[model samples]
Target: MGNWDHLVGASWRGECWAGARAELPLLLGVLPFGLVYGVLGLQAGLPGWAVVLMSSIVFGGSSQVVFAQLWGAGVPAPVIVGTVGVVNLRHALYSASVAQLLAELPLRWKLLLAYLLTDEAYMAAVGRLTSGPRSAVRHWFLFGTGFTLWAGWQLSTLGGVLLGATIPAGWALDFSIALTFIALLVPSLRRRSECVAAAVAGAVALLAQGVPYKLWILLAALAGMLAGMLAQALQRGKSHE
Candidate 1:
């Protein structure tokens, strides 16, 4: 029993390390975005404490940026909630995609992971979780990824808060958000259906740019999924012919 316990501990540590290592590269994209948000939160009149605290509580960078922006704009509480909620709908999809991988975890583990699940963490560790045969320590992999991202975000945001108004407008750190997402997205377009989905989503996003409250994101995601499904169906039909 002692040997067995020791082995399990070692396995857990190894998986955690691997997960964190995989996530390190993506931080290049996430750090700049966090810095931009840090600056934005201050510019939007959020106190330094509030800006850092939101990172802990909200834990969603994009939504946090939207919240700060809307709050600065004097948008009503209800409107802000609606907009933030809308923006975070994509997280539900992320949860669903990884649900099976985590289904067997305990409720406590599930709750912790659900809180930690962010786009970067998910993108960093998911392929590993999904690729091989299920391992006992797989949840640890996600835990490693999520915790590392959480730390990085906090540190980056703190750096931003410290920088405050000093950051140059010419730096354009917010572009990191687009670049990071594009990097995550490009590798995932493995199938023709996925390509179709991305193309349709991109078109819809461009066309809907002026839509209020960033509804274009939701619209683009839905359009992309639909287009992908249609493309997949047509491909299947052709194959059957």
Candidate 2:
């Protein structure tokens, strides 16, 4: 959130279309996620409408799955809300990382971007965002990426709603989520600090596996960040020596 001085009137349609195109590969994994969620929601006795609507309302992917899982288990609404909120706190880091790129946008654009900044969408847009100098046109790029993902989510959830249990559980499309993340994460762990962070986080996650509501993800993420920071600090110290 910055002042309006840097705001430019220019917007690029080409960048937006390109961004949408770029996001297509990521959706391959994301579509099955919605399908799995949809099937699980139905099996949980969530009304079809609720399952479909959750995609738009919660839109937080894993958090939504946690919500449905807890809901099915008859968890209290307050507890569900709290747990989901805790899980979603990772987005705070995402916002912090991308804040500068979007700082110049007006309130409406900021709000839209905030809503659209899901995990896959953010990954899709971030490269373009940091690839070069900031341009208002890049906002459209994010819009394209985020909107494509959003639409994919909605449509896939709908597909799941319509398909129901007709799809075999054995197909195990859920694995795609892990595969997608691996695709995103492995390439980025090029530095020693990143590798250290990832290793520490993975260990913490396995150690915290029993924690409910997928809270281990948040714990792992925090540990990874701290480890990465410490690694960077030690590296710098050694270099200075």
Best by lDDT: 1
Give the CA lDDT, 0 to 100, for residue 228 in model 2. 87
Query: TM-score of each candidate?
Result: 0.77, 0.75
Task: Please give the RMSD of candidate 2 to the true structure.
Answer: 5.3
For residue 192, model 1's alpha carbon misses the true position, in angstroms, by 4.5
- Per-residue lDDT tens digits for candidate 2, residues 1-241, read 1122322343587667766887899898789888778877776679999999999988987787777767876877777787788668768767888898888889999888889888888788777776644575778878889999999999999988888768664455445555655665797677899899889988998899788765675677678879988999999999999
Model 2 misplacement above 4 A: 1-11, 167-188, 191-241
Q: Which regions of candidate 1 deviate over 4 angstroms?
A: 1-10, 168-187, 191-241
In candidate 1, the residue pairs with backbone N, CA or C atoms under 3 Å apart (3 or more residues apart, or in different chains) clash, namely none
Error of 2 at 179 (Å): 6.3
